[model samples]
Target: MEQDLLPKLKETSVLIMDNATFHKGKRLQELIRCAGHYIVWLPKYSPDLNPIEKMWSRVKMIRNKFRVKDIDKLFKDYCNDLFGI
Candidate 1:
């Protein structure tokens, strides 16, 4: 995130993220602050406020619908089918 996403963002941006352990790291927070952006963590257990959760739910739903035996193969197929990867 520091190497990629942080550099692409405009200055003084507000980053809204969930309370993931990795996101709470001192280094990550310092990096964000140093980059002239702010981090706002979503409330615990508030998946509804996190838009990515809905996308994850959709991905899981699609994966379950396929029910393939091989996970690696299923992931490849899932990406191809969904994203034309």
Candidate 2:
């Protein structure tokens, strides 16, 4: 999975990733080094400081209104709800 993600990420200038075990792997390190892109990792156990975490929390609250059957609708409505229409 990381290998597949590497090519797309290479062209990007900056990426923020949470401090997780899987992302901390040596293969990922090599990928980053080869890509020559600056990577910033958030501190571990600090979801409160991450904006995406707050957004997801809001989505879960609003998602109770609708039955989710697939990824596309769920993501779309969740984003709309979070942004308040």
Candidate 3:
């Protein structure tokens, strides 16, 4: 985030993120604040409020259907199929 996303921000912004353990780190919060942005944690267990949750659910379903063994390849293929990336 610091190396890529943060430096591209054109102005101060509010970052809404899920309550992932890594996201709550003191150093991460400090880095965001130091960049003149604010952090807002999503409510716990509120999957409907997080758009990524829907995508993750779909990914999980697809993985189960395909019985994928290689996650890195699955993710790459899925992204390429879904977003032409």
* TM-scores vs. true structure, each candidate: 0.75, 0.63, 0.82
Question: Candidate 2 lDDT, tens digit per residue, 1-85?
Answer: 4557667764656667887788788878667766876678898899976888987777777667777777788888887776755
**lDDT on C-alpha atoms for all candidate structures:** 0.87, 0.75, 0.89
Which candidate wins on TM-score?
A: 3
Query: Which regions in candidate 2 have their CA more than 4 angstroms from the true location?
Result: 1-12, 83-85
| Count of backbone clashes, every candidate in sequence | 0, 0, 0
- Among all candidates shown, the one with the greatest lDDT: 3
What digit string (tens of lDDT, one per residue) describes model 1 on residues 1-85?
8779988996679999899899899999999999999889899999999999987887677678888778797788668778999
With a 3 Å backbone cut-off (N, CA, C), the pairs that clash in candidate 2 are none
Q: Give the residue spans of candidate 1 off by over 4 A.
A: 67-85
Superior candidate under TM-score, 1 versus 2: 1
Regions more than 4 Å wrong, model 3: 79-85
State the TM-score for model 2: 0.63
Task: Judge candidate 2 at residue 83 and give its lDDT.
Answer: 70
